[model samples]
Target: MWRDPGAPADSFYEIRPECTDVPKSRFRIKAGKTLSARKWHAAFSPEGYLDIGKTLSRIHRGGIHPSIRGEVWEFLLGCYDPKSTFEERDEIRQRRRTQYAEWKEECRQLFPLVGSGRFITAPVVTEDGQPIQDPLVLLENNPDGGAIVPPQTPQDNNGMGPPSTDAANKLEKMTDKGVIQWMLTLHQIGLDVIRTDRTLVFYEKKENLSKLWDILAVYARIDTDVGYCQGMSDLCSPMIILLNDEADAFWCFERLMRRLRGNFRCTDSSVGVEAQLSNLASITQVIDPKLHQHLEHLGGGDYLFAFRMLMVLFRREFSFCDSLYLWEMMWALEYDPDMFWLYEDAEETSDKSEEAKARLKSIRHYGKYERENMKNASKSSEEPPLPISVFLVASVLKEKSATLLQQARGLDDVVKILNDVNGNLDAKKACVAALKLHKKYLKKAKKP
Candidate 1:
């Protein structure tokens, strides 16, 4: 029932990236010996540089060396151009740090109570320098006493009526209202942060927990439209742990959110998760009609059960390390080779430098399908890149088709089956299956 933008309302199928066997890496980074800082620097030179596409492909082919993850991820997340020299990137890094600090400062000013971890009962001084009692605290302490008394307004030295004007009172009321809303969101963020990655030892420290809270709070302040959402804490926890730098983690998380922000929108007009669920339904119907029919029979044609999976990109469904690996691989596949050329000036090298040349060539050459689509491009250009997560979800459902068709009598049964998969999925196997299914879907989509 869901339609891709610009597609006919009746059409249920759309093309997505095809699945292919990912090549195994020859230069796998190991624990102690990662892609060194020196080697990373050498990748960029004046005449010719390392083929970023090839380098990232190689990283995806094998896992990133543990030691180099922070540096490599900065490149992967678009924090720096792969071709940028060390000096260029260092300048960019400093500027970004300053920007992040400014945003954090704005957040602090907007929500001082939450940022400073002050109790709600803390006295608020008025413009006249008079301390006002917190009404809620007063109520709590004197529940059995007579009616509560409001704080007395400050009088002038003449001991006449309070000097506070109506305008001042109005401004104070507005500030109090804003603080209340901020406190509510801050409370929810704290709750989610505490539960985010408790299984990991890093979150055991209270300071680490506070860091998670700060990033999410500031993000909420920065993007008031999306504001704070529940599952965001889960997405941010791993970044904080992996990057170890608060600003860097925030920027990485921000880059990720650009792709995922739609999922968190709760407005009536927002497509968000509903559109994705529709994509999953359409994929299932085309690839495995029987399984699709079974789900439809169970009153799950909407496929809402997979909501959590899409929301946090399967963070809960896989182990910590596996989730990170899956994310890196997905990013690699999603990498737009054109992005490098758009951001950097290509330099020619001698024929002897075959490797760099090959990478540059690959960047220039579009896939056959992509070229054909571009010739007839329409509103499709406006669509965001198809996230690999949808196909990944489809792969999981296909694997469980038999069980679902035979055992699932209702929606609850379907939820139980998918829930059982948590912590049991093999990251590599899922990626392969997802790619294969994507390939199959694209082939079918291309046919008359």
Candidate 2:
């Protein structure tokens, strides 16, 4: 994991047409600039803006519009063209499916040893103390024990008992944990495309949902102690799509799950969440201290709403294809900058102030939030580290801080503002902001 500490981190590259193959949909090219200019500057015209607006609107309406659906899906899947022959498509699908399946089995075996039942309900050490496991596989099996179990409580026989209120509260919290697990499992099963019905039910056609459930069940069996939870399905959705190969997806999800599994471990287990909230708070304070203070006053300091975004690495915000393109760009950047680091150096003596520690930490945190940590010791173990979403989020809030503080009255207002963002977001703008923040942090940390 520490092979390439000095790799130039590219998690903050600007998004342009060259990064993805999204066809000209609603966004239009401006009059003054050539396509080359637009690519170089990451610029798009007002017509382009309107198109993004339309795409987002369609998204909010519960589906990508038919006109742009193919482009959006293709882009999300990173499929530049639908020109593949039936045999080719089948081959690709089979490869992905096999990858997901094998990884799912691996994770199932490991989860039991790490989770071990009541330990999940109450734990001492995090699974991280052990070697990191495959996320795609872990994701296939539910992290929480399968099937819902109500909270357990010890009773006092001497005409006294733990307060019913306390018991109910604990049960509710436990239920939430179960819900999140379920969500991750659903996501792992590739049920992320929100349906036109507005229902969160899984698709049962051709035993698709069952396959997802089966995959999740394997994870559950590994850690039957931590069983299924709801929101977890949401976290697993992008993995299923990206891996397309079940074993690969299962392994990738398992890797992701190792870092993120703590998020829903138990009520007492909130260190991961708190760390993320702190990062968010730090960004707001560093970029716009005044707005940060105002939000803090409004109790926005808790930053609860941002939790989902952090957990899934912006999957909820961008289209799946867009998210993958953005991720691959970051990966490419990390790889390009540090291709040799894995083999050459075992350690670095650089001062923390000059090192990539914080930037690296930032990416880890964002990926943790996104639940997209890929820790496979590939042939090139020196992969560059990049966390593009942090840059994106920081840029967005920086761009809107003044307006948000001016118009909104409190923390609730801030949450509402963020939620309304829908899909009117500018990926390129966010990418630019991320780059700026990366530079800012690097400069601030430079040794005096």
Candidate 3:
């Protein structure tokens, strides 16, 4: 497991005053306006070829306006192909909604609270799939099959009326293991959902909180491999708030987890973030040897302190609005034209990976930062699969490199140096620094 070093998991971060500042009437404002609804409409040709290059550039430089962010995120997250025509995308969207509906219906059948605009704060089933008949839980039936899971043994059955034969048989068909695993995660999802974005007015509505729970519960049921993790609520809440439609938000969150779920995968011995931590170690060692050595001497070489930032994409470090802005910018800058294809056939191996690397040199729709990185990618000794976010985190580290080297006498100090950065970092500046550091690192990696 990745060691969570400091602060309770539920703690909130403060936002900088600049996040709420009046819009600066400057070039950036005009540049950002280029991504307005009108510009977005114009970006598509008559046949609906999205000018992804232009759109990506605009988002990277100026970030996205709130009104169009969710839509733009659909493309950025690879939910829809930019190459697809308008009609094709519309068809895909409808099909995905139907598909999501099916997934939700499946979960609703297993658990009554799904799509009920209410969520449970306690587990409704025990580890062995026996229903927890708590008055607080109030387990009910799915109209089609009725999901009151039959108690495994009579001793466990507390005078409950027998389930209808049809409901019992339907549940019997499901694997005992799958049912237990899904059932166990219900309350964890609920607990996280209520606490997620609570300080924001958007989540003050109980229905809104339940909506997030519904999306997450459905996700955990469908994605049994990763299941429900605490930080996932942080990732899902923004999607719920940004995209008004629950299914769309679910799909968007699914796409994000496609990229991020690896971080949550853990074993008794190790953590998934270790891979990125290794990459971050490499970047820091190469970029600033002195700072890296100082950290190593402080027993901070593992970079465990950065676990939260990578886990939740710096959600706690930046203000909610600024974090959203940072996400679009990072996604735009890291945008890959081949992401849709690659993600779909992710299990395919070596040959496809090589082909993708080769295509990077000539692809026209890649975002600004990725496009430039491709030119130098060959020169770099190694290219980590997910480089931008790690580099962005590295940029944040470099932002505090001096303080870290001077006063970070131990591991805790290193974490404190980072904690001080919470909410004060600038999204635009951090992104710019990451890109600069990326180019420099690429050049530095090429040797005689």
Instruction: Estimate every model's Cα lDDT from 0 to 1.
Output: 0.62, 0.41, 0.74
Alpha-carbon error at 224 in model 1, in Å? 1.7
CA shift of 403, model 3, Å: 0.9
Q: After superposition, how far is residue 255 of candidate 2 from its true place, in Å?
A: 3.4
**Where's the lowest-lDDT run of ten residues in candidate 1?**
154-163
lDDT of 1 at 102: 92
Candidate 1 pairs with clashing backbones = 19-435, 19-439
When 2 and 3 are scored with lDDT, the better candidate is: 3
Comparing candidate 2 with candidate 3, which one achieves the higher TM-score? 3
Can you tell me which runs of candidate 3 are displaced by over 4 Å? 1-34, 135-175, 344-362, 377-384
How do the residues 1-448 of candidate 2 rate in per-residue lDDT, one tens digit apiece?
2222222112111223333532212222222321122232232232221122222222322222222232343222222112224464456446656755565555434333211111111121122232212221222222243332122323201111111332222222222344335323422222222211112122313233334444555565455445445455555554554344444445445544554565556555454555656666766676678877877787777767677666665655654444443443333222211221222224421322434433323332222212222433242246433345555666667777877878778766877788765445544445545766755744453334
lDDT measured at residue 198 in model 1 versus the true structure, 0 to 100: 55
Which candidate tops TM-score?
3
Candidate 3 on 1-448: residue-level lDDT in tens? 3323232211122322433532221112343343667788889899987888888877776766555778999999998767668898888788889999999998888876678766655555667776655433344432232334222224222112233333333443334798789878877776576557655656656678778888898888888888888899999988987898898999999999988988988889987888999889889988988988998999888889999999999888876777788888889888887787766544532434555445433466787677777776666536444558898988988889999988988898898889998867777888899889887777686653
Q: Order the candidates by lDDT, highest first — what do you get?
A: 3, 1, 2
Candidate 2, run of 10 with poorest lDDT:
155-164
TM-score ranking, best first: 3, 1, 2
| Runs of candidate 1 exceeding 4 Å displacement | 1-50, 113-172, 175-183, 269-271, 337-361, 364-385
